[model samples]
Target: MTDENGWDMSASAWVIAQGENGDFTRQFVLDPVIDAWLAGRSFASALDVGCGEGRFCRRLKARHGIVAVTGIDPTEPLLATARAKDPAGDYRLASAENLPFEDHRFDLTVSYLTLIDIPDIERAIAEMARVTAPGGTLLIANLNPFITASGGTAWVKDDSGAKRFVKVDRYLQEHSDWQAWRGIRILNHHRPLSRYMTLLLAAGLRLTRFDEPPAIGGPTEARAAYNRVPYAHVMEWTKA
Candidate 1:
């Protein structure tokens, strides 16, 4: 099945996996960095591109006091769940490649761990830049390119079943791989880090901050494992 279909099929499981606190990476790694960057800043409106289940949208409002938060995703089942959870929230059925909104409409735009799911990343990044108001921020959290390039077989474990190192190949190649775990199956696209950097820079966005954050808190073992090979990075950009 197509990745889109897979998301539709696994919507329930996905929602369950991301309970109230979110998964380990989100709870410990991404959220802290996001919150720190957003601290003391207020925006009237925000857009969460590929916002599954409206998690970050709610976070923006509840934590940051953002008044108008909109979330868009291609998966209807996910949108349905989002709307069900936040009945008054503006959750739209849309894809990142073609956002259903006016140009420069949002004060702050976000793409949290969703870039890998986008097939036409160039168009999607352009669309994201187009909809972001001048001076508005485009914050993104994504899996590290090395982790994606590893194709889910990143760890090389020793005889004692301890990870020795990460195995990565074809780092310059762009491809897709099927990933299945915890009752969810999906296809994620992999691109060289240079590809993402070049595209974002060409989109007329200026990079304000970049980070490969380590886990701040979680299970001792899990956090230590993640810190050994940090799998995610965050980039904050602004449209000029």
Candidate 2:
């Protein structure tokens, strides 16, 4: 989880500017994560891993009335931002491969667009399934690999941005069904669609639902860039 690349994960410039300039991208989260969770049913406690600034976690609390919520991430700076928003919910500095919690402690576990960044995705997912209480939901989300493979045009504009994008694509291209994701230097495990499904099944999770949120969760131009590939996708399953 140590991002040696020194990517500016320090409260994503997007998130920071939103906070400072009062233009957070939080609203976009509603269409996919919160709304999707509520559509299923209310759960007692939930945990969000890779919880950038805990923005979505806080929204889940406020929007769905989930009483117990926690957010964990390896990024200390981001965790600090999450803490500032909701001091009540537990916030931990941790990695997905080895969470700092007891087995089966949470009713639901989720990560937002984070799996692609994880170096050890299978282990991380195994941990996710391992920590979920039986019958509890485990949600995995990422940008569609097909989008990247099909030349979905969501590239970052500078060297800093290109590095982040390349690091992710390098690992993901291995499982790329979409064709365009096959370049070398891909450091991420951005599995293709089938891999996502296969891993969930292998982890003993019963498939429940999948979501491909509309146009980057909204049609706005700024967000549209990310959505250029196909906004968001969620794979839901219950531990069995």
Task: Report lDDT per candidate.
Answer: 0.94, 0.67
Model 2, position 10: C-alpha lDDT score: 33
How many angstroms is residue 187 displaced in model 2 relative to the true structure, after the best TM-score fit?
7.2
Error of 2 at 90 (Å): 1.0
- RMSD of every candidate to native, in Å, equals 1.3, 6.7
lDDT of candidate model 1 versus the reference: 0.94
Candidate 1 on 135-223: residue-level lDDT in tens?
A: 99999999999999988899999999998999999899999998888998888999998999999999999999999999999999999
Can you give the lDDT of residue 15 in candidate 1?
97
Clashes in predicted model 1: 0
Would you estimate the TM-scores of all the predictions? 0.97, 0.74
> What stretches of model 2 exceed 4 Å from their correct place?
1-14, 17-26, 29-33, 149-172, 175-189, 216-229
Q: Which is the leading candidate under TM-score?
A: 1
Total clashing pairs for each candidate: 0, 7
Encode model 2's per-residue lDDT on 121-183: one tens digit a residue.
788888988889999988766766754443434444585554233212443455422212212
